[model samples]
Target: MAGIQFTDSAQTYLADLLSKQNTDGIGIRVFITQPGTPYAETCIAYCKPGEEKEDDQKLQLEQILVWLDGISVPFLDDALVDYATDRMGGQLTIKAPNAKVPMVNEDSPLNERINYLLQTEINPGLASHGGDVKLVDVVEGGIAILQFGGGCQGCGMVDVTLKEGIEKTMIARIPEITGVRDVTDHTVKENAYY
Candidate 1:
């Protein structure tokens, strides 16, 4: 409601597009599809008149109605909706730098920050090896207790993967995370990749 900036040209373009559509009373909805993770997305879709919940933040432009989920409004603060033309046909883009970036703040809870980093950055990489990591707990003195699964549970290279890959990344990204301890039972060796 307060953060979205619908420029004149953008309004014109969107109005034109909407006018051409078969939408009776429906409008445009801007939303964050995946709130966190590397695949976090900011998108727009045509919404039926009844599709929008009352709590959804509705931005009533002079030419068109734009609806955003209440939760998405904060992430889209100071966002710009614009149309850009090139050699080919023009494209409408939502320029919201803060939208897709994970909410990893130093003042946030240490466990929350660590979980954000792991889900958004670390786990995606490990997933390539049929593995994943989870935060069991964050203990005193900023030590992180983690558990590994899938291919990482019993791999011989898991130690190297932890020290060189996981620890290094976590420590570098989060200065407060002084140490990471993997509590996975490597002796099981059921699904080790190597």
Candidate 2:
């Protein structure tokens, strides 16, 4: 909240847009989709009264009320919302420096730490093969269960990829994880790389 900034022109433009919506309690909601990954995207959408999530941080601006997505707040640090005009017209621009940067630390939760590593390390390598993995849950005894998607789902080389690549990387980086397990039903090989 402290780091997000809205320029005067941007606020006025947004307020005008909201007013045109004609909804009594319409406002703008700011969120980052696919936060903490290369695909992270900062978005602003019209949010009518009840459209806001219960956990959202309601930030009241001078003439507009903004609901900030709680999960995306960290990634929105130092975010900027501005409006620029040219000969053609004016366009609103959003700049979020940390959107695609994984934020994690030793004190962070186990699942968060695992996901951060997956996003920052594992996913990039998997992207080359059109595949990726997601942390499903941390079961008892520190077993980090995961679900693979895309080309890795039914890839014949998934076993080697798991044991040699993913498992080794996760274990070496996160000591709390006793092991990694795949929960994906790989029987459907529609997108399998191999």
Candidate 3:
């Protein structure tokens, strides 16, 4: 599913933008932030030489090179990048129909399905408290080890959030998950929500 369409006009415009940067091997990196959530945003950033992540997929367009963010690939499915000229100069637009849509199924790997629920269902609720969770690993016995970040890492209510919110949501959606465990060191309180 590596089919991200970049319109000819967008290629031209992006190529021109890169050339003006006066840097060799400069390219554009495309990604969606907060993907699978209503707050998702498609972004294009100038990527200097060696700025791309190891997992980024490179696409050579007619006039430009694009580095697609690995984690954002599924959400970017059917995405369109185009440039349109109005009465004013012109505007570059990115239309990603699937950016806010979660993509996963029972056939998907356990890790993928769990992460999908975390990003789509659980994290959005946590984000309101300036926190989120990451799947550290899926150990034996269908156990999911997670690490909390941001406000959740050291929050006072982390235990409640873990059991009542995250764990409940994960187990309900993916029955194969025998249980969820938190690996976060909650003593740090630096960014705790409460």
Best candidate according to TM-score: 1
Task: List where candidate 2 sits over 4 angstroms from the true fold.
Answer: 106-194
Give the poorly placed runs of model 3, Cα more than 4 Å off.
106-194
Error of 1 at 87 (Å): 25
**Weakest 10 consecutive residues of candidate 3 by summed lDDT:** 115-124
- Candidate models: Cα lDDT each: 0.83, 0.90, 0.89
Q: How would you encode candidate 3's per-residue C-alpha lDDT over 1-194 as one tens digit per residue?
A: 46689999999999999999999989999999998876999999999989999989999877998999998998898899999999999999999977986788899888888888887778888999999998999999988999999999888898888888888888888998888899999999887897
TM for every model, in the order presented, reads: 0.62, 0.56, 0.56
Clashes of each: 0, 0, 0
C-alpha lDDT of candidate 1 relative to the true structure: 0.83
- Top model number, lDDT: 2
Cα distance off (Å), candidate 1, residue 2: 11
Evaluate model 2: give its TM-score: 0.56
The TM-score of candidate 3 is: 0.56
Q: What pairs collide in candidate 1?
A: none
Model 2 local distance difference test score: 0.90
Each prediction's Cα RMSD? 5.8, 6.5, 8.0
Model 2 per-residue lDDT tens digits across residues 1-194: 64788999999999999999999989999999998877999999999989999879988989889999999998988999999889999999999977997788999988889988888789889999999999999999888899999999988888888889999999899998878899888888897896
